[model samples]
Target chain A: MEIVVCIKQVPDVPTVRMDRERMTIIREGVESVINPLDYIALEAALELRQKAGGHVCIITMGPVQSEVALREALAVGADQAILLTDPDFAGADTLATSHVLARAIQKIEPFPDLILCGMQTTDSDTGHVGPQIAEELGLPQVCGVNEIHREGKFLVVKRLSDGFVDTVKVTLPTLLTVTKGLCPVRDLPLGALEAAFSTKDVLEWNMTDLDLKKEEVGFAGSATQVRRLRTPPPRGSGDIIEGPPDVLVGHLLRRLEALSILDEEDEKK
Target chain B: MRLEPTMKQAVIRRSVRKFSERRLIAAAVEMDKTEQFPWDIAEEMAGLQYFGLEIPATYGGAGLDSVSTAIVIEEISKANAAMGLCISVHNGVAASPVYLFGNAEQHRRFLNPLAQGKKIGTFCLTEPNAGSDASALETNAIRDGGDYILNGNKVFVTNGGISGINLIFAKTRADGKDLGFSVFIVESEREGLEKGPIEDLMGMRGNPVCPLSLRDCRIPLENRLGDEGGGLKIALSTLGGGRLGIAAQALGIAQASLDASIKYAKERRQFGKAICDFGAIQDLLAEVGTRIEASRLLTHRACDLREKGKKYTMESAMAKVYASEIAVEATRVGVQIHGGYGYTKAYPIERFYRDAKVCEIYEGTSEIQRVVIARELLKG
Candidate 1:
């Protein structure tokens, strides 16, 4: 059995400086870090690989800079790392990024039985990429998975969803989205970090490695677009109406009636 | 790779201040209530790794940085102050001089085992008349056939009662002034050595605080920390770094006080609501949080500057003063928040409040920190 883990490199928000003059992300001299949620994915993957006889391979898609994230994975315990990096992959949205990763995983020869990814990226916060990848690969997927218990050929999981706990069972070939409910990744010992330095180098793959037509990958296949991103226009400043309990209640009712929010027989009815 | 410390450094700092692995300081706070001297705590601190913070790997130490050493002292002090002071002074005065000044043979004989946490050491600087005034110390180490016979009494010597090694500073000068001051490392088995009975104190009572005297005590020639007249400089540098660790201890005490206050406010009720719900209590809580943060930032900033290999004497002195004063004020406010319960021994606030005062007196007094800052600024 083999496992594939997807991770992303994101800017360390605390260290990332803003360029007020140009109004742009000042990447120069700023540090990039592995997305925190990726820790859970890596932890889960390593645990599974250790219990079952298998290798956990890490895959990340970005520019040359993304190697930092891959090296972090190796230092933590991933057996091998692959960097799906190229200039042409720039400006790819979650949908396009997922398709590229799906194609790349499919090309891993002895394909992995399971793929694990973080539930969300700190920078994007979109949370759409993992599900899109599962759909693209036609694999059964589980999200918000906190734990995975092995039962012969299948895997049973404890998952969290909308104020309820769901136990889902899935076959060998599947994908999972992990959240904080999962165990935190262990910090690597100094000896392990030194060993990682000697053993792991990013295996860079270009567009040709995925064996995908230009029209079917990168920004070309993506279906979503962000017309423009801006701060939500300031909600006209909030006002507090203060008085005794009865007077405050009367004032709140008048305001709600003005907005037709307290109308009788409405949604509450 | 980014410029920031690697994740290992960001997470697991080096182990500088530690106790011996062979000995563990049993954590029994109640036994210390009768002013019991924590000889076991000192031995346990040596066992845990605080005795030889920077004495290199070859010397059998973990060889961690100053920041990590400072953190260890801080954590230990949070549980007990006497234990923390014992640790800081041993490393600062006893082990530090030998590591910094002793020759290869001296280091091999003394520094090696001490760094490895096998033994304890003491710093003998203060005299009956001199406390902060190191230059005025009158201890005499007169030469006698390849050995120096030491005479004079040292007061308020930290770890004086339990240490196996004593790094004593005394005047070798013909005149009775600060000049010709020399440091000697004397073994505990030396003849003519006297340890005064433990002095009574309101705080840090769990550790022994006593006077150490040298009456015709002789030390080998090779035991001197440096040539005559270098002792004062050595003392200043060691204590300069020592102040940083003391500041960190103060920060921890303050944080623990604020933490206790926050916990009590959330649970205790007043005026029919959890006191924490009251705006006045909320304001008090906010002030406690704010001061704790400020204390930590100042303490760490001085420590970080020291780690960068910069001159931080003034910064360290300022941190020591601010953190010490803040610990007292914060613990006082903590007691106030607990109301009548705060003043009682039922809670640890009363103990914390008592422990916070001595930080201002030791190392260099808050008044001395002012002097150092003023001198530094004036010289600039």
Candidate 2:
């Protein structure tokens, strides 16, 4: 059995900056850190591999610098790091990124049995790639996975959403978007840290390794454009009308009536 | 030169404190009641190159500087403060005389073996009548045809009862002058030389600061450390370097007290709340933490100065005075924070308090340090 955990490198949240004039993020001088959410995903993948006796390979798609995030996974006990770095993959949105990542996953030497990712990236806050990639691979996708257990060849996983819990059995080749609530991760002990820093065998791959066309990566691959960017205006400040339930209800009714949004019978209750 | 402990030295220093190789202590609490200096522990320290601290590797010592010596003392002191002082007195105070003033042959014979820890050494400067006054020695070493007949009684001599070599200070013949002192490396096995049992003290009880008496004891002329009447100079310089070590010792004590205080304050709860959360307790905790850090920095800086071959006498004196006083204050507060539990020996704060007081008294008392500081200041 094999597992592929997707990870990313993002600037530390506190130090992140946006270039207002250029309509982009300010990367220079920002301290890049391994995405915290991705650590949960990596932890999930490692645990699954450990329990099932399988190999865990970390697959990531970004520029050349993305190799750093991949290396971090390797240091935290990942079996290998697969980096999909190419100029053609620049500016690729979630849909494009998922497609390229799926291609890279297929190109891995031993392939994979399952795919894992964070519920969302801290910077983007877009929860689209996990589902998109699962759709592209024709594998069943599980999001907000709080508990995953191995039962024979299939996996019993608990997915929680909208305050509802669903226990599902998914066959091999499944994807999960993990949340921080899923599990707490830890930094490896000091002795292991020295060994991790000394060990180097992370696999660095490019478009050519996946037999990808140059036009299908980087700037050429991205489809949709992010043109004008600005924050939505702030909501208005309103008075805090505190009172007994009857009084508050009466006041609310008058405000709603003034706005012409209340019906007469509804106010009696 | 920027001096730091080599990796091997750091490991060895820790090993001694960690009790890596052998059982240095027979039992944890026996040394105090029986003021018996463990020759085995001394041999182990010598084997590990701690006995001859600051003696270069070429001279058979671990070749550590004053700073490295302080670090070693700190680690050892964490486990046993008395043993820490024992090493400090032997290496830093007793050994400094020969290392600073001895000739090439003297270096080869006395320093090399002492540094190698093969032959334990002691410095005999304090007498029944003289404690800090270097020039007021009553011991005499008159020239008697190729030899100096030594006759003297020195008290409060550290490692006095146990050490193999004694750097004895005595007055040589002079024209009715203020004790023209000269230092000699006295062997314990020599006839008519005797050492008394350990002196009982309120704290640092384990170190056997006893007596070294030269009752008609004769020594070879070559045993003299440096030149004629240079004993005072050698003793002062050696003691000046030793002051930095006391500062480091005080630093360790203060750190332990501060750590114990924080741990106690956080755990011990008062009426409905943890004591640490209280405004008054919080202030004590913060002050203790900050002062401990500041003292550690100053102490280590003074140690670094000694290692760099730069003159740090005044700075070391200041650090010794400040850190020692801080130790007393810090440990007292640590006991106070314990709110009654800290007063007992069951916890370390009380010992830390008792230990803190000695740092002020020894290695040129806090008053002496101020004198040295003011003198240095006035000279400029």
Candidate 3:
């Protein structure tokens, strides 16, 4: 089985500063890193490849700088990396991005038996790319997957839904959007990085390479447009009531009653 | 062109940072308290090629440049100084000499295992009589048929108890006259080689700094590194690079000290505001931060010269002395910033304080570094 992992390079900061006027992230002075959840997806792909005896290929849609993330993935034991970079591929929304990725995956040699992706990206947080790509490829997909394994010819997936875990079995040629709880991220070996840069080839694909048309990718193909963006307001602090236990209880009850959080009839009963 | 770490080097730094944050930093206090060698962490680092930073990839090493090697040491030392010391001694002195001076067969035997982390290595140069004065070492190696019998006690051997390959230097007599020195690769499993108990130290307790006694230990003729009486040259060259490693380690300790102080200052309140608001605390922070950046630049300059195959003896010596002294001072200020809590075992600042002092004394003392710098200047 051949596994393909879709990765994204996100800003390496807790809170990203956004350019509200431009409706985009303020990339200046911000360092880029592999998306946190994508590391879990890559780890999952690597584990499965280790057991099944196949190649783990990582694909990412970003600029030339995003190749660092792909090389990092290679350092952690990915067999190959394909970078989708082109001026036309910029400003793509989730639907356009998934369409481009699906075309790129089809261009990979030997094809991919399994496709893996993070549930959502930290920058966008749309959580639509994985399912959209699955739809684009005409393949089965599992979203928000916390655990996954191979059972015979099918894949077993476990995901939490409404506070209960749902386990489902799906056939091959499937896409999985993994969560952070899947597995621990492995360290990148120094020798592996040296070997990757010196020996491994990180193939680059453009619009022509993937046979993508101008109307199907990039800003021209994007269906959603952001008119404005802003950071959320800071949360307000809670009120603390302090006194003796009886007095505190009385104050809490009176406050709750004043706020109408408690029913007077129920309190009397 | 840039003195800062390259993109690839930055990746390496981040990887090490992640590993150290999760593994070494959490276990540092317990390891210090128990005085136990962190074999597991060593194994993990070896798997990550931390032990083989400067070694060539063909020889089961990472094949990174000298600057990258220093970065690895600095990052690791920031988390745990004792582990840093072990790696410095192993890579800088022990494995490096064998790779530089050893024959093909010797490299295949000794350097391979050491680089692979299957076996730990250490340099045995300091004797009871020879601390800074290496020529005064009393250990003697006698030439026997097909073997050389080594009889000496080496003191303060880093990674001594756990090491498998020991690069030992001893005085040799040739033609009825005492020649300079000879280096030998003595395996720890050899007969008559006894490892002393771990030293009870004020700092860097996690390192197995111990004594080794070699009584009639017979090493094969091929085990000798370089030529007869060529040990001094080998020792000098190995230590020239080793000083940079120590400097980087010191820089790491200093940076950690400043980090701890800054963290504590922000959270610790006094006089109705955080202590960080005070002018005195801010002064300490600024001075330490500047010193650390200067030390890093000096250390990296030495590394750059070494990588370019230029003479960096004086540069490395200057860096070592400056960085080590700053480390001691910075940790002292770190402890002062924490006030009473820094003195207790509850905080890591106390551990940093204890670990900082030894950086000035090891590899080469600050006095010795100053002397080396002066000697190089005089020669020019």
Candidate 4:
């Protein structure tokens, strides 16, 4: 069994500014960290591999600095790391990023039996890369997965849906986008970290290595482009209405009726 | 001539900061209130290899440099000074001597498990009679055929009760004429060893500081560290590095005080304006920030010297004195900035105030550090 985990590195600050003209984050002095939710996905993959006896591989697409994230994954027990970096891969949207990742997965020996990803990235927050990768790879995909376990050749996953959870069984060679509820990430051991930083085996690949055309990757292959970026306006402070319990309920109901949030006739019906 | 940390050091700082914020910060206040040793957190930190941050990889350590070790201590101390004290003692004074002076066999037997965090280690040089005048220790070890019969009482030992390995210093006589000191690696599970109850201290309450009593404790002669009469040299050398660890801890505490003060000053209102707008408060903040930065530079300079195998005795002493003093002053200002809230347990500044005092007293007192610096200067 071979498991693959997709991760990304993002600015570590709570709020980031974007360059509207370039449609990119102004990352001059901001520190980068592994996308926190991806740690949960990587933890899930590691746990699965630990039980089922398989190797865990981590893949990320970004600039050279993304290797820091890969080395961190290696420190936490990932067996292999592939860094997909190229000038052609720059400015790629989720669709092109997923395409390149799918191609890289195919290039791995003894192709992955399971692919795991964080449900969403903190930077992009689109939650589109995982499903898109699954579509590109033609594999069954499970998103918002909070729990996963291997049952022989199939995967039993618990997915969080609106108001309820759905337990689904998918056959082997499936993709899962895990939520933070999947599992808590363990601390990286010091010895493993020392080895990871010193080793030179982290494989770096480019578009040429993946056998992809320039037009089929990066910005040229992206289907959507960001036109503008701006911070949302600050929310107004709330008003507090003080009255007797019955009067307060009545006032709230009257306000809701005034705003057309509640249909009085429908309520009567 | 860059004073800032290198990229690798920055990475270490970031990683340690994340670890401390996630694991230590929440428990720090509660641990201080309850005065409980954080055994679970210690186990977790060991898994992270914080217990062996500077020891080599061959001994199950992080194989990091002295600067990296200092960075780890500083980050951890910023969150919880008590845990920081435990780590500083374990890595700096206790385990380092073995790695530095012990033979390969001793390293395999003692340093490996201690560095791996499989067993906690501590230094036992201070006794009832000896505090700063370490050579005046009353503990004695008598050679008795293939073993040494040891009898001693150690006080204020960090990680005392929980430690599995203890590096103890005792007076010995290879020849009847001369009174000399020797160091021994004594296992806690041995017979005739008694662990006293943990001390109720003013600060750094989470550290399990306790007294240890040994009566006729039998340690194999093979457990001796370095040659006979070389114990003082070993102790002094180990403490040179240990002083840097304490300096880092002090720097961390000082930084924490400044950080807390800044946040509180900005949020607190007085005279219909934020207190931070006042010139008095700004002066205090500016002074604290400058002193903390200066302390950090001194500590880092000592760490750099140690990394390059240069003699850092004077440098470490200077760093320890200045940084610990800065910690006390910064935390005091932190409390003053919080006004009445600082006196109460409602704020963390009170705890920082308590914790900062010990940095001046332990490792070496401010006066002792001054003496060391003076001695170094006069020698030239």
lDDT scores in order:
0.76, 0.75, 0.90, 0.90
Rank candidates, DockQ, best first. 3, 4, 1, 2
Encode model 1's per-residue lDDT on B306-349: one tens digit a residue: 77888888889988998898888889889999999998888888
Model 4 Cα displacement at A2 (Å)?
Answer: 1.7
Window of ten residues with lowest summed lDDT in model 2 chain A: A188-197
Top TM-score model: 3
Candidate 4 to truth, TM: 0.92
What is the per-residue lDDT of model 4 for residues A179-223, given as tens digits with 9 covering 90 to 100?
A: 977888776666676677876368999988999999988999999
Give every collision pair in model 2. Answer: A88-A217, A88-A218, A89-A217, A89-A218, A90-A218
Candidates 2 and 3: which is better by DockQ?
A: 3
Encode model 1's per-residue lDDT on A95-169: one tens digit a residue. Answer: 889988998899886888999999998777888888988998999999878889888889998888888889999
Q: What does DockQ come to for candidate 3?
A: 0.68
* Docking level of model 1: incorrect
Lowest summed lDDT across 10 adjacent residues in model 4 chain A is found at A191-200
TM-score value, chain A, candidate 4: 0.91
Better of 1 and 3 by TM-score: 3
Query: Ten residues in a row with the worst lDDT in model 4 chain B?
Result: B172-181
Write the residue-wise lDDT of candidate 3 on B14-47 in tens digits. 8888889899997788779999987888898998
